[model samples]
Target: MDTDRVRLCFYRLLQLFSTCAAFSLVASLGTGMGAVSHWSMFIWCFCFVITLITFIVQLGEYQPSLPFSGKSFLFTYACLATAFCLSASIMYAITYIQFLPHGPFRDQAAAAAAFSCIACVLYALEGAFLWLLFPETTFYFATIHGLFKLLETSVACIIFAFISNTSLHQHQPALVWCVAVYSICFTLGAVAMLLKLVKFESRLHTFFPHFLLGQTMLSVLLYASALVLWPLYQFNEEFGGQPQRSSDVSCSDELPSTLCIWDQKLTVAILTAINLLIHVADMAYWIHFIFIRSRASAITGL
Candidate 1:
């Protein structure tokens, strides 16, 4: 089979899996019996499909007559694969440690075990890829991304460890912590990259295609919104945890009890809206890159 054909196959498979997962998640929300369990299973299946497709695509033989060498293409593939695996690993880990055990399904324990094992393998592969493809010019950006991954992976590991020791699953604190750290790191790294792009804007036309530049800008916007949304969600969660007022309290003495709920709901709604926008922008950029832009520059010819 040709490389392009294989790539297309992988892309189609990912699209299908993503669609099914979205549908299953939405459906699970309306079910009363083991909703979390069913949702977790769907997500696990989604991650496994994405990870396997990504790994196969990364390993496919592609011979391009571009200015860049094959090693550059391989490095880019590795970076993308790492990113996919990181996301999959985090989702799998959370589902296993926090959702699966309390699930009513008979196979929940087995599913959790499988997810844990997969997460370990993905973590190892992500680290190896990072070490192999560390860029010289983008050292700061790479370092920040690496640190963020480390923190995220650590949080997953700690949550698993806690679950093992206590035989109880609780992930709110870890989720809040991971999201907070990821938001800060993403904001700083995106800002730094944006500044670099601005400094080199005069030469952008010479070095990059217009479509690619636009796609990069869209990616920046997506990351920025994600960074903002993470903190907003965390703040909402924190505030939502505040103590409730007693009904016996006098009206004059009671501060507006509804205010807290309204504030939390407003923050959550805003974050959700921004997140949806980010996803839309991400999809648009992905389509532009896949169809219109040349693949040569996409993999920075190290």
Candidate 2:
């Protein structure tokens, strides 16, 4: 095929993959824990709407000479891909706590986690081609897109760490303290970056690489290591034992202890397995990106 046709094929592939990812995300999140925060609902709803808009816009028959700017398409897909990946990671991590043991809930959550993994892969594809579609694009939107790419992985690491700490909050309040510190650092870093993005601060630009490399990478690995270590050894006992108050109070029967134990174990297993897949994908992404093209690394030095 000709060059324009090849590019159009990439566009079509992106829209198609993005659409599938969007619908899959909806299904996974809708039947999830069912107690998602309002902000979580809003973020997912926004992702669903935007991906649909992207699909529809790409498929439309009529357009001016330039239907949509390529930069606009890049920005839109970058945003959608980030949203899908971020939200799915959070859902996968958080839903593990809702398990009820021998019932079908753990099974459902596992299935949802699997679907979210699929969606994350698809959105990654969408992000990859956004760059392939325009190899020479640089600055602003390009940097924003790259930042979101990092955000997907870093944010997942943060979620994994935060929840791991939160899971043991009762026993290890000190660990929960780490969550507060990390969250503050992440928030402040994000705000500072946004200001730099707007004001185009040269001084911050010089230090941005250090933040992305040293600070952000270390923090991501910090939580990721904890997540790997925790479930590997301590998933079973993380919930601690039931209270003797149930017997002392009377008129109360605790959940079947065996089944409850099974619930926690299964949920931990599922979450850990999902996390392994994501880390594998991230490693593969790093390798593929570093070897396949130097331009991406030229952007972030990763």
lDDT to native, each model = 0.40, 0.46
Clashing pairs in model 2, backbone N/Cα/C closer than 3 A:
none
Give the alpha carbon lDDT tens digit for every residue of 93-145 in model 1. Answer: 44333433344442444344354344434434443544454444333224433
Predicted model with the maximum TM-score: 2
**TM-score of structure candidate 1:** 0.33
Task: Quote the positional error of residue 224 for candidate 1 in Å.
Answer: 10
Using Cα atoms with residue i matched to residue i, what is each candidate's TM-score against the true structure?
Answer: 0.33, 0.43
**Whole-model lDDT, candidate 2?**
0.46
The reply for model 2, stretches above 4 Å from the true place, is 1-43, 49-122, 139-167, 170-172, 192-302
